[model samples]
Target: MEKTTRAAFAFLLAACAPGVFAASSADLSVTGSITPSSCIPTLSNDGVIDHGKLTAKDLGRVTPTLLDLAEIQLEVICEGATVFTLTTFDNRAGTSAINPAHHGLGMINDDQKLGSVAFTLFEPVADAVPVKTIVSRSGGARWAENAYLGHEALTSFAAADGPNTPIAIEVLNARLRAFTIIVPARDLTVLDEVPIDGQATLQLKYW
Candidate 1:
């Protein structure tokens, strides 16, 4: 009887060993590196472009109304000569009356889109040398000169005589022109004071 009991206990232990020692968890790791170089970007006028007050009568009744053109100076200073690009983010995303490429001016009545703003970069100078503006729609895989800086595109500067490739620069200065358009008045509710709220952020990306 003692031997039989001992054998039964050993069988029970073996049967439960796998259930007690089985792996029921896993580990995940996240990692990234911080570059020693950094860049800072600034815009003129504290990055504010006020369209001023406009009455409902000033808006277009059937067609989209074109607002005045605004220009701001963009400057980028790097810790050292670095290859980088500029990308834009629309704070008022998905509200553009036109398309995703354009930045949005807030909506009206909670659902009706108000308008959009388009940006273009021109007259870029790098390290005191005149450079051409280049844009990459494929996340820096390929580049083209004098293209519109859409929301999905990256903007960089290249030497005037060089091919359409981004270059390293310590300082960069360029002109950003903003073209704004309001949706047709018929599509919006202008009963109250509707503000034109358009905001965007320009980001510097290492190439």
Candidate 2:
């Protein structure tokens, strides 16, 4: 298995004011882990969802269009049990929104925003036991009862089969839904053939 490595950047921001020139600051912390445990990740349909060909007439001018919902089976199996969460690194940065719900589709000519894509996680099975997507705002103290596919924060996670904490189960299989949309015609004028490229990297984070 390959080694997983990561680095974090922290920043302190202070609010500036004239009358009350007091320093009000907050800590920006990034944390991740590289564990000895390793997992094999796989996606359904050989990880390919082809839309075939498209023309300007297929897209909209004022309003963006949505492609049909695509389903993919996501499975991960570790050599041994380990606790981890999947963190997504959007490859097409600067072309999408900062909101965790959206990831940028590749741009046209490296300028115009092409569109966006989002993934939702569901129907999870861990080590033959049913699993739910749960988040802990209090750092693993409590977790959500139900898990919905949405943009989970870096601090959020999917709970274990029967515990508040996420356990490193031997195998995890889940259904994933991906949403793809096209940018408004006003922004993206596909004068020529352009590739609908959207990429993201998902790394397992050890808690």
Tens-digit lDDT track of model 1 for 141-196: 99989647667899888999999999999998888899999998899877888989
For residues 1-207, could you state the per-residue lDDT of candidate 2 as single tens digits?
123222211121222334555557999999876778787778888877666778878887888878778888988888888776665677787666323457787778767888888777777888887777665545456666544333344322344535555666678888877788887677776778988887777666666
Residue 57 miss distance in model 1 (angstroms): 1.6
Please list all clashing residue pairs in model 1, or write none if there are none.
none
Which segments of candidate 1 are over 4 A away from where they belong?
A: 1-34
The best candidate in terms of TM-score:
1
Identify the runs in model 2 with alpha carbons over 4 angstroms from their true place: 1-36, 97-101, 135-152, 155-164
lDDT top scorer: 1
Instruction: Assess every candidate by TM-score.
Output: 0.83, 0.69
